[model samples]
Target: MAVASDKTTWTIALVGNPNTGKSTLFGALSGVAQKVGNYPGVTVEKKVGEVVHDGRRWLLVDLPGTYSLAPRSPDEMVTVDVLLGRQSDVAPPDVVVCVASAGNLSRNLYLVGQALELGRPVVVALTMNDLAEAEGTKVDAEGLSRSLGVPVVPIQARRGEGLEALKDAVESAGAAPPPTVPQVFPEPFRNEVDRLADVLNGRQLPRYLIERLLLDVGAHIEDRIGLAEPDRLQLRARIDEARKRLAEVGCKTPDVETTARYAWIARATEGVVTHAGETGSRFADRLDSVLTHKLWGSLILAAVMLLTFSAVFSWATVPMDWIDAGFEALGGLVEGALPEGPVRDLLVGGIIGGVGAVVIFLPQILILIGLLTILEECGYLARAAYLMDRIMVRVGLSGRSFIPLLSSFACAIPGVMATRVIENRRDRLTTILIAPLMSCSARLPVYTLMIGAFIPARAYLGGWLQLQGLTLLAMYLVGVVVAALAALILKRTFLRSATPVFLMEMPAYQWPSPIVVVRRMLDRGWDFLYNAGTIIFAVSVVMWGLLYYPRLSHEDLAPMVADRERAEARLEAAKAANDDAAAADAEDAVAAAENHIAGAQQRQSLLGRAGRLIEPLVKPLGWDWRIGSAALASFPAREVVVSTLGVIFDVGEDVEDEGEGRLSQALQSATWPDSGKPLFTIPVALSVMVFFALCAQCVSTLAVIWRETGSWTWPALSFAYMTALAYVGAFLTYQIGTWLGA
Candidate 1:
């Protein structure tokens, strides 16, 4: 399934309710032919996959998993637009495959009925048939197909079952006429919808949207249609009258739609679905009883988290070492093959070193994302939310926010994007504001570097617990704690709203598909590498330029060169005389002269000058000009901090493993010129780690926030508040650590 971008492709849209195996089906259908991008001016993520089936090209688009077609926010309205042929660049789906869980047919049919309203070719791909059969309930595909006036095929996407049948059904439906949509609402409601259509004459709004316009009260659709209608007063008056009539008839505006849709669904699915004598999910139920226990469940969750972080640290070490060595060799080769000049410096230090620093973390990213995808695919992740719901409620949020927050542990881009499921406007905003606080994979490189360099390797609990691992875990916890406090403050203050009740359907447990897991892992790893190559790549070059130029002339370096030459001569003479002590002293003098030249060159460079400019502000946090400069350079990309430090300390780009901390040793040996005191202590390292943990330094994340909220103000506010929070946190960390004599 690899169709090139051309005009020969027809688009097929997949729509379904949440937890209906929609994404799994998508993964099965698209395989590795898919690409992720954002839709223009909206929060929708465009996951388009190109496939060639039956000697023809088809583009499968997996829309957001939605429960209903009703539009509430501007974001939700994009769904309606895409299905109705109004969305830019996406032609109305030639065939719409409505994914339905066999075990939950009645509820799933609600969205199916709404899709039928589009009068487009429809096919139902029934998933989780095995799970349904296990519960002593089975769905008759032929019967359901007859009842809904469309083809229905049972499928188990995880196992590649019924995929050919599903594809055939979709192909057949595309060539056939549109399926029939049964009458849902009663006469009065239909009459109101018709009347609204008549009043908005020549507006050319689709008939379905007009129905939604009257159905979804106080929704964004009202504001959407009203903006262009010449007679806003007339439309509003008619809508008000329609709602009044609806109320008088005991059929409210929105609930009337729900009631009618479900009633029709029940009638259609009455005999199509049958219950069996035995329970299919009995074993699963028993397992849940133990897994959801208060004490055992919490401990298990902690253990699982511990295992995940530890694997990210320890399991990927060998691969990380291999990658680091490979980059080091490449840099060394480039240096050896080329003469020492600006071009060679840029290639060695800026490109290899800068990009290599980030690529070394690929193994860790793949491991983390793979683990997360497994947890989510196997259905344990949803249970984790159910387990954590009580705690989430105390902070004025429900468990739904936890999924996005947990995802942030991998990357904030998807984490922030996941907030679209949140229905409440203020609740969604609050979650968005704090999602960045969850330590993402970008921070992992920094955390690992700092912890490996500063934290001791003490073991406890029969060697199962290491101090370095605990320190890494503590950094993540700090983010969670601060996020909770931020949520509490936001909820109690201006963004206050009633804490929405937590409601979720626990999916049945199953073995995770290795194909899906690997595809997802590779996809995300590529995203990270692409980012490192592009934005981080460019930033590293600029940083090198800042630290490189305002070159030290021969006039300035001649004295240090002469001093080094004298020391070398003395060392040679001492060696000839067989004087070990004198030779050792001369070696120290030579090293000092070389250090003096490197330090002087860096001090007068642009980066050093800028670092000095902000030294006063960072002094309280125990950061000198060099550390401050690294922080400042990393504002666009947080992971660049490590590479920046490498350049500043003249340690090239390749940082070695824990056993031989090349950059780490350089940092420990650094000292302020005036005081001759060590620049990097444990407290200062802790402060730096804390600052990066809390800071909103990723420009891409802020841009995503702007896209999600549709207001630059929100992103601006997020940056301001997060930066302030980071400064105070770092200051407090350093102050307390020093006071405690750490």
Candidate 2:
């Protein structure tokens, strides 16, 4: 053990069994200084924080919770690395605080026992004291503390109790003398663990190494070690012999040494533990009745999902408007203050417009994550998964896929990374492949803009519903329907296999900690800005250049510029000659007149020439050249379709302008030259909106797909399949509508 020095900061690792409120305790101990980041070379997140306890500032590492030291997944590998000091980036923790849920002492101590075996300073924090007491159960805290050779403090973490005792134990551990005696393991298992340790002599080992040597089930562990073929064969033979010896003595060969550790823990826990009658908590029983009911469960899940989508659109509108207005004002500020040059264009057009395109969508992401975190923390998420499991199973997906799918509603990268939980390799890969097909937060801006611009606001079919709202709802449904259908096709064809079984342990329902919820939302928001925001910015720059440069020689544009300048000069001279009130009246007339002339010139510019060139090809689909160009711009990002239309129609970047104040309205009022019909007719707008809805219009999504799959093959296939689907779907919609005289 290292001595605590004035210059050295002690490292404390928060370790506990699963479902012991360790995360809550970590959040309580280290609040704002905590950072949630990914562990190196893996997507599994690590949280590190600093705390001042007993006049000492300690760095705390919150290790992932596990049932035992036996590593089962990638997340569990993090716990193993930190405990063994094997992670090069993080120092081994100086002290370990094992959080034991009072209601489940025996199981919790199994982890504590294993931690103690590592020969580190260990303190036990007994959490959920109130829950135990409410169930008429009592734990002899002091007696148990004596038996375990450590200090124990009873804590009701949610109510802020016994925090001082926990801190005192940490301080005492920092200055304490090392124990002389080593922990003894029992019988045949002890001998076998020793044999395995001898086999691993002079080599650094994972915490779960001994356990993995016992089970020999998964290939991942042994693969990491690169054990020789002969040595691995000998190890397997020794494990079989050990299992046979244990069976002869009427004992089972434990999967991990920690299993036997827990057996001893159970014996030590006797007499100090008692269970209450009925064996169930009232709150849990009540919640399960409604939340887990087969019929009501599905209905509640549907209602919750519907409400979440509706709230995402309705609630985020005000904040989105404010963000839009702020960007617009900032753009105008730059244009007014800076001299007319590349710097001004860069500020107003390139940087502001490109960044604003992504930033304005932040409110939608925040609201969506907030709602999701509440549902997840409140225990409804598990029940929703249970309800969806039957349908998911039919498509060769486990109930575990539900969370990833739900996460896809926010972003696909996290959703793809989340598939690490599905133990089956085939199922996990399939989930990763299809996750991007589900609509994401990035698609929301496109959906809202298109639906608002194109779909009629008035209700149809005698006020049964607003056609526009239904169209928006239908767009969401299209993604869901396509995703499910794609899963079915993939399962039946390429990734054909048995549907993996879903086995989940549901947690007791409790109110979420507001601090944790807010932290989660902020983490997600920052992740979006840092990850997806950068890609959108770069793509926007390319798209902006594609539409902006190759200027008409200024010689070609000189005629239009000279004409506009002469007209503006005449209007200014007329305003100067008039009286003050008359000049104000003339100002409005001059402004509208100038706007119309500029709008016309833009329509005849190079972009307009290209739109006209492409108009014939798109005319059958109910789009003129301008709509065609907007659709083309939407390839990099669908939301760019909205802003591009604004630019094309000379509606300055103000997003909140409505009531004949938006370019979409100008589009709606404009007529086709040859057809003598409105360009944005009901069928045409719906078809275009539908096209935007289903396409892979996000570069970030494609990038994530590439990163996650570790190949461009899947993303390329995804793009091809989705673009084909979008075009065909839009084509069918347009043709059918025209046939019906829509």
Give per-model CA RMSD. 3.3, 5.1
lDDT of 2 by residue, 1-742 (tens): 6655442578888988766789888888887788878788766768899998756788899987777666667767777778777777778877789899877777778777777777677888998776676656678898887778877888766667888788888778766853322354556666666776776775667434775666545656676577789977776677777677766765564543555676678777877787665344765678688877888877777667766766666677688777767777788887899887656765566567666655767787788789888887776787788877888988888788887887887777678877777767677777877787777766666666656566556655564445555566677778777777888888888788898888765655667767768887897788667644565556555545554554456566566566656656766777778766655655655655555544455455566767778888777777878788767766655566655665454333443344422344556556665554667766787688667767777676778777666789888988888888777777777889888987
Q: What overall lDDT, based on C-alpha atoms, would model 1 receive against the true structure?
A: 0.85
TM-score of each: 0.93, 0.82
| Cα lDDT computed for each candidate against the true fold | 0.85, 0.71
Q: What C-alpha lDDT, on a 0 to 100 scale, does residue 478 get in candidate 1? A: 91
Per-residue CA lDDT of model 1 for 156-215, tens digit only, reads 898999999999888888877687767788999888888888877688898899988778
Ten contiguous residues minimizing lDDT sum, candidate 1: 1-10
Q: What lDDT does candidate 2 reach at residue 605?
A: 59
Local lDDT at 569 for model 1: 97
- How far residue 481's Cα lies from its native spot in candidate 2, in Å, is 3.0
